[model samples]
Target: MILIANSEAWPGFSKSIECLRRGERAVDALVAGICEVEREAKVRSVGYGGWPNMLGRMEFDAGVMDGATRQVGAVGAVPDTLPVAALAREVMRRLPHVMLTGDGARRFATELGFPIDETLHPDSKRVWWERLQKELSPEALAAFPDIPLAPLSHAITDPERVRDNTVFLGRDSAGDLASVTSTSGWAWKYPGRLGDSPIPGAGYYADSRFGAAACTHTGEMTMRCGTARTIVLALRLGHSLRQAVDLAVEELKDLRDGFIGGVVIHAIDADQTHRVVSLNCEEPIHYWFWQEGMNEPEKRAAERV
Candidate 1:
């Protein structure tokens, strides 16, 4: 068994391996593992205290994939719930649909016994205010309290500051692979904006035949390129794991509309060998991984592009 996840999800590594060691299905172990990350208050880009939207509300998004069946479930713009990862799993298991969004997602989560709260933690709200202040002068903000922040307008806010995504991938004893991705979506975004996090084959993908791939960084690039799936497909077509990731990173070079600050990809081959790749990243990238015979999860730096 093997588990690989973005470095931000380090808190989940041990628990995920434990679930795998206990013989849980790859999907189950992956979900169980990410739940720890989602519940962690320190990771503000994910569940719970994640950066809020322009309206000061925390909306979350998550996706889950089952490699053996190629099935997926996703939830977007869900508010006040840290269990969206589990909810995505429930959607895959109990619902015929692949996704739910906004109020519908929140309603479904509530029906599934997930908590619903609109109150942002003080620290989270403070973070929101600080970001807002970066885009608006104190006088302008006070004069137009009802005005919505427009991140798309170069004259307004800097959207780059809000970008973040997280991912987790696992392969079970039988070699079945599965993946999960969760994010608060773009910070200070429009009230109901949805990103690649809840988009299948965008945020993550897995196939028992070739293995799994998942990513963190620019969601729009992933959504446009189907990056995670692209990596796995490259592997299926005979590219080495690192080569597959490199091809995906190379594709990002074609992006011309905006700056791609960074991108990090985590991949695991059918043999359970794993590789992490980072493209144009400003700092060193790291990821967490674990397998049988390992006493604890290990953190390793990725190959930088």
Candidate 2:
């Protein structure tokens, strides 16, 4: 078995590894790790405590891909819910649809008895207010939730928020690979803005026969390029892991227009060989890695080209 996840997933990756050690299903193990990040108020990149949308709502996005089946389940722009990654897995198991969003997603969780997590960390809310107060005029602040936010969305930016998401990719003992992507998305984004986290073939793609790939942060670039699927296709077409990753980076570099930023890719081949690379990112990236026979996951720096 092999497992690799972005650094933000550190909080709960151990549980995921443990599940794999005990021979649990690959998707289950991936969810086990991501749920830990989702439920923590401190992670601030995904799940409960993450920064909210322009209106101060904790809207979440998450997705799961089962490599053996090529089936996907995802939720986007959901509000008042926790354990979003787990709910996405449930969408795969119970529903025929590949994705759900907004009120529909919330309703599905309710039908299955997922609890409403009314708790957005107080500090997160405070920080959001502080930023809003600085960006919006007193009249705009007074108008608050009643005002149109999409116009202001681009105006109020959180430089760090766009660069955060929890990405996990794993292959189990049975040769089944899986991936989970979870995030609160860009802070102060327009209401109902859905990034790449919930989109299959863009943010995440898995194929037990070929390989699995996941990307974080820059969803816009990946969405247009279908980056995760591109990496897997490159691997399936006989590209080496390094070559496939670089190809994806080259594609990103080709995009000379539109919103663009850094992206981190985590990938693993059918033989359990893994690679991580960052593109146009200001800082180095690190991720957790472990393969069969390893006692613990290693924290390694991602390659930058």
Candidate 3:
């Protein structure tokens, strides 16, 4: 099994993977572990203290994918819920629909016995109130000479970028894959805004018969370019994983808003040939591996482009 998650709280995610390898169920392990990390770090894009929406409300989104069967379940725009990860799992289990959103998502969560609360976290509330106070003060207007003060201006402008958490677990066999992605969207975004994180084939894609890949950061570019799918298609067309990622990044580079952030990919071939690629503005593409023969994971963080 292999796992890759993006968070400042890496230790917890790493520990969770270890526990899952021990005996815990995969879904349960992932949700519990991630939630625990979120609680501890108070990251403002996941559970509990996540960022609020434009309306000063908090809504979360998450998704899980089963590579074996190519199945996916997702929820968007939910508020004040634990196990937001579980909600994604439930979508994979109960609903025939691939995705749910807004009030509908909230209703479904409640129906499934997930509790809802008007208040999310004290930190989120405090941030919202503090921003409100700042906006209301006459000093704010005087401090900014050109920009005008308004509810929408301060509320929705420049929504905070939330880091997503992703995990991929599967055997070393040539054809086996599994993956998940969870996020809270952008902080202070529009009420119903949705990003690539919960969108199938955009934020993530996996297939045991084909390969697996999950992406994070720059959802807008990923969605427009169909980046995850593009990478997979590139590999299927005979490009190596490294070549595919480089090509994908190159394709997006010339576009107006292309490839603004980073992407992480894990791919394994039928022969158990595996590759991991981490691409970002500041770092050149690199690879890592934990193979059957290797006693520990080997990382090659630097390579000439």
Candidate 4:
């Protein structure tokens, strides 16, 4: 068994590895792992105390894929819920729809026994206030980064300096593959905006016949290119894992000179081989990796190209 996740998922590494060791399905292990991170109230990028939208309301997004069965589920723009990834799994098992959003998502989750509340974490609220003071324009009561002076104008300054998302993929002992992605979307983003995390074939994809791939960072570019699915399809076409991921990164280069904010990929092939790639990101993108032969999960870093 093998599992790989971005650094934000480090808190859940041991638990996820335990699931894999017990011969759990890859999908189960993936969700179990991400739930740990989601439950953490201190992480500003996902769940609980995560950063809020520009309107100072917390919203969440999550997605999951079961490669063995080709079943998928997703939820976006959900408010006041932390275990969205698990809710997504429930969606895969029960709901007829592939995605749900906003109050509708909250209602569905509540009907299905997920938590619901209108309270915001104190820290998250504080951060939202700080952002308002720094980024909001009193004249318009809108974030400076979101204003438009004219059609097709480049007047709006980008507020996002860096973005983070948690994406994980696993191959179980039985060779079944699965993936999950979760995030609070871009910090101080427009209310009701959904990023690649909740979009199938954009931020994540899994197919037991080929492999699984998950993406993080600058969700817009990934959404536009359907990068996660592209990587897996490249593997289906006989490209090496490294080659496929590299090519996917190449597609995002036009965003800004040769960078697209930041991008990272975690991938595994049917043969159990794994690869990680980063674009315009910090060097040595950290991730947790564990396989059958390892004594314990290792905190490894993948060099960005």
Pairs that collide in candidate 3 are none
* TM-score for predicted model 1 compared with the true structure: 0.92
Q: What TM-score would each prediction reach against the true structure? A: 0.92, 0.97, 0.76, 0.90
Ranking by TM-score: 2, 1, 4, 3
How high is the lDDT of residue 179 in model 2? 89
lDDT, model 1: 0.82
lDDT of each: 0.82, 0.89, 0.60, 0.82
Clashes by residue pair, model 1: none
- Top candidate on TM-score is 2
lDDT (10s digit) by residue, model 3, range 1-305: 54444433342455555545665544455555555644543555565656676567777777777666778888887776656657887888998998988788888889989877543676776776666555556775455433443455335433344544444433423234555666666666667777776777777776666666666556767777776677667777887777777776776565664336655554544344555555553545433334444445444553322
- Candidate closer to the true structure by TM-score (higher is better), 1 or 2: 2
Candidate 3 local distance difference test against the native: 0.60
Q: Which ten residues in a row have the lowest lDDT in candidate 1?
A: 151-160
RMSD of each: 2.2, 1.1, 5.1, 3.4
Q: Worst ten-residue run, lDDT, model 2?
A: 154-163
Better of 2 and 4 by TM-score: 2
